[model samples]
Target chain A: MPSIECREIYFSYRRSDPVLKGVSLSASPGEMLGIVGPNGAGKSTLIRIMAGLLKPQNGSVLLEGLMLHGLASDDRARRIAYVPQDYHLVFPFTVMDVVLSGRYAHGALKIFETREDRVIAGRVLKWTGLENLADRKFEDLSGGERQRAVLAAALAQEPELMLLDEPTSSLDVNHADNLMALLDRLCSDQGLTVIMAVHDLSLASAWCNRLGFLDQGRMNALGEPARVLSFDRLKSVYGDSVKRLDLDGRIVIAPRGKRNTNA
Target chain B: MLDMDKTRRKLVLACILGGLWLLACGLSGLLIGSTSIDIVRALNGSGPDAQILLVARLPRVLLAALTGGALASAGVGFQALLRNPLATPFTLGVSSGASLGAASAILLGLDTALLGSAAVPLFALAGAGLAVAVVYMLARRRGSLLSTNTLLLAGVCLAFFFGAVMLFLHYLADFGNSYRMIRWLMGSLDITDIMVPLKVFVLTIIGFILLYSNSRRLNVMSAGEEVAQSRGIDVDKVQRRIYFSGSLLTASVVAATGPIGFVGLVVPHVVRMFTGPDHRVLLPASFFAGAGFLILCDLLARVLIAPTEIPVGVITAILGGPFLVWLLRRQVEN
Candidate 1:
């Protein structure tokens, strides 16, 4: 059974303009679904509705056949963790303290982290390769390291589902590749369902099993990567000419036709 | 486990700082007045000047400490709740609301005696509450909380409005009452006894404890509203509680001491720089540091011009304005 199902979700920030226009999608457990869209396409909004951060005006979101919108915030947090792209650490919070906050939904009144929670947070940090940086100030870390810390915090929730919005936007090429690979492992090894809104169509093609293309607050298409990553659909949705090439068993999307040589 | 150790260490250090502050301020407050009463003789309650020292200087020092601590702690909560580093009690219209309340009461012939002291504080509290409610309402419209920048702008505008109202009242007041209103506007620690400010002090302690008890919640809140909500925190409820409680503390103190400046803004940031962002540490540290900081400032206010005591606000502005500028330069340099 799918871990999440959204039915005709409609959302709008302003009354006249809709952000998500009846967008509906579903993801099975352990599946990595990548939502690829251009700017202002409501990719993040759809993810937020799925993660129960924002309520849909007309549609319902269900987790395991249970309506997610009706559940309490802690219940949703216990089952899923959402990591947004921009994480600005305004204070001198330690890496461990920030990660330990992931366990907050489990124990609300426990101000100090329990030993068990600490062990879990530490394990997750180690998995995310941030164990050595546990004591360092979060703001003091490099951009890639900070993104890893964010991943560690999300992983510490022990969630069956993870939602990420542009997890690689702030990272360099190597860091982005490493992070996507790590997420892929988590999905396969732990049967964790992952849904991420990504801008880089190439990364999505490489890492995601399934793809959902959003355009103008609507899901234009949803299917396997090969089926959704076709040249025609890619060009239509993104308006940038994407060249799909088969390099052995892997598929890569290159900007073949859109490059302007006159510059 | 390490966090616990750090929390304990912070508590101990804050306590030490507070104790040293109180002791130094107490002695200075008692000894630096017109007569230069001896601290040892005052404490022993044996000198011919003992009654004057115990009754006058003792209450003044305690009031100054309490008012300072209250305003500073309120500052910390305001900053956290608003998620703006520039937030403070005075800037948020809390002091203006309180001052308006106090000034209104005084205009109605309540200033000649202590007959309406409790009433003045109550009205001041109400004024603060109303101003906060207005700010909250303005920041939150049509069901969503407003952004931090908008909230700050609204608070400043409301503060200015209240200040204008207060000025209008000042102009309409009689000659004798006008002089009293002008003095009160300058801010004084001239309460005859410790009871009124002591009540405010107790409220400050209670309010600060409530704020500190939820320090962990505050830590998560500092991340962002969506993150805090996604983490199971009732962000709206917590924000409302913080706003109400912080405003209560701010209004009460402003009423008690006629709006002393800069302690709330300066103390919290200084405390955060040294103690880090954990509210458990920040709250208590701000409390003690604020109390100590204000008392020391008050001591300067009295002795800087021995024969004619400058308003405590003047002392704080002179000290705090320069210190803040230096801090800003340091932040930029770092």
Candidate 2:
């Protein structure tokens, strides 16, 4: 059975046009699924829906053959963890504090942090290679370090499935590659299912086992990268001013010359 | 785990220190009223000192402590709920609403004609409830999403509206009632009957517990609402509880103290610098520290320029004003 499945999902903000229309997808263990799309193509919204953070106006989400929305939030969080794109980091909470916050599901009624929770958080921090920076305040970290810290916090949830929204938006090239590699390793090694909304098509194509191309609130393509990201498909969705090149057995798309001017 | 234990020890030690400081402040308040007194002789000997200490100063100190603790606790919750550090006990304009209620009650002759002195606090509480209800309704948007902007704007509008009503009432009152209303507005903890304030303080403590139970969720929320919701929190439910508790705590304290300022806005921030952002530690520690701070302020109000007392509100403002400037500048430099 699939770990998470969404059938005919539809969502819209109040009184506005639909942001998602009849979106259906599913993921199983030991796989990395990437949703790649232009800005405002309902990528983040879909991830939020899958995380059980939003109620779809229509359709349903199922996790491990059970209804997603039926379970309590803490129950859902135990199975699926979400890493948000934009963190509001208002206070100077330590990295340790940030990771320990994920243990709320483990101890909702307990006020103080327990030894078991500390051990788990420490293990996650070490796994994410952030053990050295555990004492540092969140605001004091570099961009890559902060991203890793948030990832570590989500890992503390001990989830079977992880959903990330634009996890590499704040990282440099090396950090982005490093993070994708780490996620890739985690998925295959631990039988973890990772579904991420990625803006970088090249990274998505290279790392993800399956890629879903979203355009104008609809899933245009979903399959292996070579099948889903055909040259003609890229031109049709992204317009005529793009070029696709096969570089060392990898499909790389680059913006060619000036922007498309006339209709 | 050793560090975890160390952290707990630090938190416990801090709370103990805060409790001790509050105790010291209470003792000092007894000693430093209008006239200094040696306590052992006063309690032992049949003198006016015993009456002065127990009847007059003790209740005053307790009330001051209650007011301060309640305001600071509410402030901490509101700040975390709204995710804005600038939030205070009065941020939602409940204090102005209470003030209006008290002012109108005084002017309407409710103090003498109907429920006697009890009527004023009753009316003020009603006004506070009205203000909270209106703001709560106005801020609500699209299925459980409470708009922070709307809450703030509605609060500001209510504050202005209530302030105008208060001024009109103040303008129309006769001189004797006018003096009474004015004194209540300036905030005095000097009440012969401490029963009403004590009950409100008890209610406020209950509210603090509700906030404390959600302190972990609040720690996650400080990262962002989305972050909190993603981490298994029922964001809407938690937000509603925190907002309700914060409003109740602030309203109860304002009704008792006639709108004490500075303690709400400054105390939580001051306590946070020491406690860091852990709401579990921050909540109780701020309560005690705030109590001590207000006791010190109330003592100064009494001791400075003896025989004639400065309004406690005036003392808070005079002291709080410069402290706010320093805080603002420091915030910018950081």
Candidate 3:
């Protein structure tokens, strides 16, 4: 009942240059979908639409066959949790306080947390490996730690769908792997539907169940990673500079890897 | 769980100091007049100068304290809601708008016996409300308030524009009316209208209590509007309440004693310095401190020229200007 489906989506920040053009996709509960594309492929725009943060100019987004926009903001917040690409802050709220704010959509009359609310927030913090940093100020945390804290905060909402926009864009290798593994486990163990736009092809291919390749605000391919990340599709979507390498059962597409081939 | 011990300690401190300040104001109001009276004899209600004591001095002191308290508390509310250190009753243009309304009433020759009594304050409240409405309409984006910079700039510009209108009205009024208007703008304590102080005092106390209870929410809101909204606060509703209460408080104070300056801006920051940013402690402290500061300023205004009173606004501005410079330097150094 909490499935998300988009039909004929179209959006643009400016009238002449549409960011998303007639894009349609569906994601059921408990599935992890990875979206990959070159820059300006409308990946971020699509995530925002799915998160209910942005409205599509033409077409509709439905959560379990119900129109998403018609629902109350609190109700939408309850069902869909969004972690944006950039979250800057000036205040120094504690990590626990940040996480506790996730329960905002459940009730409006009572703003303070109950015993149950604190327990849930604590549990999510523990789950996301942020229990040790509960008392630490959010701004004091590192990039990876901040991302995990945000993830914990989003998880505290207990939403059915989680939309993470480029979660690993600012992380180191160890952090990127750890975050991907965490998401993979959360998807499988807790049946959380995750739709993330990832820049790293290897990470997406390694963890995601399905992959969608987008180019020029249109979907080039939508299927298993093997089909979506195929050499022919990659060449068409990203130009001839993109080439796939097969070495010892690992697959990698070098964005500029071919330029160094003559070296 | 309540921290009863800390609360009790704060309460005791507030009461002791506040009570002392109140008594001092009352004594000064009586003792500094053209004819001084004995405090013990006055307290016993057997003093020979009881008529002047009961009629003139006590009312002026009480009116000053009440106006000061209201303005300071409203200043605290505006600063927290807007998340700006620069926001105050005067800086946000509420006082300017009130003065404009008062000047308008005078110029229209509506300062007659039948209508002048009520028209000034009512129109002042209306002017303040209209000013807030225009600022809100201009500064809101995507149903949220704009950044503090934009809001402060808009308020300052509107205050200047409204002040110009008020000055224009000053030129059209006759010499007597113009002199009255000038004194009013300079803000002097006048117990001639005791009923105004009594009405405003009751409303101010009630408003102060209601606002003090919501200080926790304001502390949370100062971080950002998005954070507050996501924490289950109906941001728009709370903001409307803050604006309404703050505007009314400034208007009432202006109505009671013309337009006092700087106490609303200065007292809250001074309160913040000692009490931290937690509004729970800061709000009540600012209220009392504001009353105390204004009483002292009024005493200075009286004794500086003895029997020929200087405007309270002049004293506040002279003191506040130097304090503001120090605060700015401190902020920069930090």
Candidate 2 lDDT, tens digit per residue, B1-334?
Answer: 9757866776798789999999999999888888777799788876788778877787889888888888888989988887888888888889888888888889888898423578788888888988999898988985778877788889989999888888888789988888888888888787656576678768888888888888878898898877777788888888888988988888887887788877877888878877788888888888998888889999998889887877888888788778877876887798
- Candidate 1 yields a Cα-based lDDT of 0.83
Candidate 3 structure quality by residue, lDDT tens digits, A144-170: 999998888788888888888999999
lDDT for every model?
0.83, 0.86, 0.76
Candidate number that wins on TM-score, 1 or 2: 2
Q: How much DockQ does model 1 earn?
A: 0.66
DockQ values of all predictions: 0.66, 0.74, 0.20
Worst 10 residues of 2 chain A by lDDT: A254-263
Question: Could you arrange the candidates by TM-score from highest to lowest?
Answer: 2, 1, 3
Every model's Cα RMSD, please? Answer: 2.3, 2.4, 4.7
Can you give the TM-score per candidate against the true fold? 0.94, 0.96, 0.80
Top candidate on DockQ is 2
Candidate 1 per-residue lDDT over residues A1-263, each given as its tens digit? 78999899889986669898888899998899999988999999888888788888898988989999888888888998999878875667999878987888888877666778878987998899988999899988999999999889888889989999999998888999999999999999999999999988888988998999999998888998888878788778656555678888678877755344333
Summarize candidate 2's per-residue lDDT along A190-248 as a digit string, tens digits: 99999999988888888999998888789888889988889888888888767777899
- Give the per-residue lDDT of model 1 (tens digit) for B244-302: 77877787788787888889999998888888888877887888788878878877877
RMSD of 3: 4.7
At residue B208, candidate 3 shows an lDDT of 80
For candidate 3 chain B, which ten residues in a row score worst on lDDT?
B1-10
